[model samples]
Target: MKILIIEDEEGLRESIAEYFTEAGNICETAASYSMALTKVELYRYDCILLDITLPGGGDGISILKKLKENNYTDGVLIISAKNSLDDRLQGLDLGADDYLVKPFHLSELKARVSAIIRRKMYNGSNLLLFNELSIDLQAKTVKVHDTSVKFTRKEFDLLIYFIANKGKVVSKNAIAEHLWGDGIDIADNFDFIYSHIKNIRKKLVEAGGNDYIEAAYGMGYKFTGK
Candidate 1:
């Protein structure tokens, strides 16, 4: 999963980022509102952890409004010390999917973030199925025609990204960002992405799966599942 932590507290932000990264996720952090705004404008994320308080001039709610203006469709989980019912409700009203109060357990935070992503991408269903292909989100397992098929971590993440956006043409830049976050320089990464896709196709074919990934001519690739 790709997540952005928009928080001002250095310790808490690092804690959250480290926890997620250790779990094999791509996480980016911003400690000030200006930094957070720049991130939101430039990249996409599976979920965002937004803090209402910030040392920078702006607040988290303004960030939420910008997301709205940009038609950014993803999960937003508010993580703030402001635990009043009104604050919670306001966050939800502005389209946050979930809320987590500060001083939270890391385990609980992970659970809530998982729930929010599932809700956004999988309609809250943990098991994803398309024809004979099945993916168990909790287990990180993929099955083809009822038999288990193993995938490398990168391959599995790529598969889910394709399925999540299914028919849409996914650009190479988007693929790079999804798999690598903003940590890597993907400007000249066509060869890298091509290799991964080639391997993914090979593995699926060896597992008796259909040729589902379709090239979009000059565009990118699409998951036609055909």
Candidate 2:
């Protein structure tokens, strides 16, 4: 999954980014409100870890309001030191999926973010089913008619991204940014993406699964399965 960490504290932000990245996720960090705002405006993430107190001009609430106003469907989990009832209520009312207090365990944060993403993408289900494909989100496993299919971490992530945005023509740049965070300089070439797509298509087809991914010529690719 792609995650954005919007926290001012360098230590905590780095910790969160490292943890998520180690777990086969694309992570981007923003220390100030302005940086966070720029990231939110430019990219879409599976979930965003927001810190209420920011160093720049606006607070995290303003970012939340911006996301809501723009109607972005990104899952938001607010992580703040302020544990007041009013703050929690206000964030929830403003459209945050979940909230965690500061100094919390990284495991707890991961669990909460996983839950939020699962709800948003899989309707709170651990198993994601599409046609003959059955994916176990928790296990990070995929099966086609009970026969397991092996996928590398990147392949697996790309498959899920395509499934989540099924029927939409996802641009190459979007796919690259989603797989590798915006911080990376991989936008100049799409050879890596083509290799992964080729592998995923071959594996799925060999496993008796339908070929649902279609290239959109100069545009991008789309998961056209119904």
Clashes (candidate 2):
0
> What residue pairs clash in candidate 2, if any at all?
none
**Per-prediction TM-score:** 0.96, 0.97
CA lDDT, every prediction? 0.90, 0.94
Q: How far off is residue 92 in model 1, in Å?
A: 0.7
**Model 1: per-residue Cα lDDT over 1-226, one tens digit each:** 9999999998999999999999989999999999999999999999999999987889999999999988999789999999999999988999999999988999999999999988888888889888889899988999888778888888899999998889999998789888998766746557777888888888788888887899898889999853
Shift of residue 173 alpha carbon in model 2, Å: 0.4
Error of 2 at 49 (Å): 0.4
lDDT of 2 by residue, 1-37 (tens): 8999999999999999999899888999999999999
lDDT, model 1, position 40? 95
